[model samples]
Target: MYLFILLPVILYILIRKKSFKKVLRLHKVSPQQIFITMLLILAIQPMTALAARIMEHLLGHGFFPPMGDMSANGSGNLFMSLFIIAVTPAICEEVFMRGVVLDGYRHIPLWKTAIMNGVLFGLFHNNFMQLSYTSIVGIILTYVVVFTNSIYPAILMHFVMNALSVLMEKYPTSLYANFTIWYETNMVLLILLAIVSICATILLLIWLKRLSNNSAIESMDASDNSIEASDALNHTITFVEWPLMLATAISVIYSLMMVYAM
Candidate 1:
């Protein structure tokens, strides 16, 4: 919480001397917008699952367990597990990624910003198995925040994704599990399903973008730009910064250690 949430808030306040909410992109979004965002994330599941499953097949099963499963055990109840595995990360990570990180990259074009944000997020995880799919999801989440001009939709999307994972983990005999069993055996079907899901994901994203309030997004951008002249800390940080470099190096070393240790 301190690293992802509080630290960003402190840095924003110290630098911008402005309301952290604007920098955090905390604009309010409509209910329909959030619902569509949830659907978008659900649509993305097959693709992400395919990425993870393919990597798992290549590396052998039991290599990189789901972080949620690692932390949430049978000792925890459903609510506790959900809170630990889903809710907390949704809030904390969204605040850091979609809020602080995205805002920092505002000067760049949307596509570049989203991709870079996604890459950073993937690297943040430090696990080779998760890097691809999480980066894809991170890109989608960044676009979610950008389209809706709000952080809440991304948070909801994140929660739904993780919560479903937790629920599925809890109930191994669920339909999803059955489907996964079948899916693993059918390579042709898996590829077809992944393609269809990707198409659906594209459609959902376009629909969500159309539903977004353009004026609000413009207003937010203008609001931030308006303050740039007076705010000395408005400058963007390059990737070469010592803090980012150090963090990346640590993550890589840790991931390598885990791989060799296993």
Candidate 2:
């Protein structure tokens, strides 16, 4: 996961952002939109998780094993693990998968490219049970990156979704056991979380719609500014320095291994 995910990301952000200002300008994302997206990540994650679970069962899998193993260590190690899983992936994966790979295919029909990118992302995961569920999540994220044209938005969304699952996993099994009890134990906490998750879903939907409109306006303005440049501008990454790519690959792999090695 580390080698596959991060090496290309560091290369893209450092190389692409510098070389391709037009790519950066393709999506107009305001500060307000970014904040709302961060909030929505906290809100919509549980719903997304539930959705993934349902898909697993529908696909004949009982439950999907998580990509991030929460209890791997750190009885109190939440902070460190959060860095590896949430912060690192938010940046690297977004840059590599969405920014580089998805945008690389911009010439294809936009929607098709987005969905295909999402499916590819899902398959990129090592976990077998998560393939179907993560694919759905990947599709949503792909649309997000395409519409906004910024990895920041995608990274923010990904962070929120991941942090929550880590928190849940780090919780004492004793505490969660109560919630897991079918008849009556920890239902209250789970119920409250469910409510919070639903609220997050609604807010996320609103935020996405708002972003959609703003993006449309920005695209129109851009098109008016240039009939030819819009078409002339390309999204592919070429001639990336090999050194940056190699360093990034080593850093990400070492970081993840050090964190998860426990």
Top candidate (lDDT): 1
List, residue by residue over 22-87, the lDDT tens digit for candidate 1.
Answer: 766778898889778868876887787787778788877743466455444535588888887688
Which consecutive 10 residues in model 2 have the weakest lDDT in total? 235-244
**What lDDT tens digits, residue by residue, belong to model 2 across residues 1-262?**
4565555444556765554444333355888767766666555545555555555657776563543454344344788878866777777666666665654454444455556666666655545566655666677676566555566688777887766567656663655433433312234554566578777655665566566654533543454445454454442222123323443454456556756865
RMSD per candidate (Å) reads 5.5, 7.7
For candidate 2, the TM-score is 0.60
List lDDT for all candidates, in order: 0.72, 0.57
| lDDT value, residue 173 of candidate 2 | 61
- Give candidate 2 misplaced runs (Cα > 4 Å): 1-4, 9-28, 39-47, 58-70, 73-76, 172-262
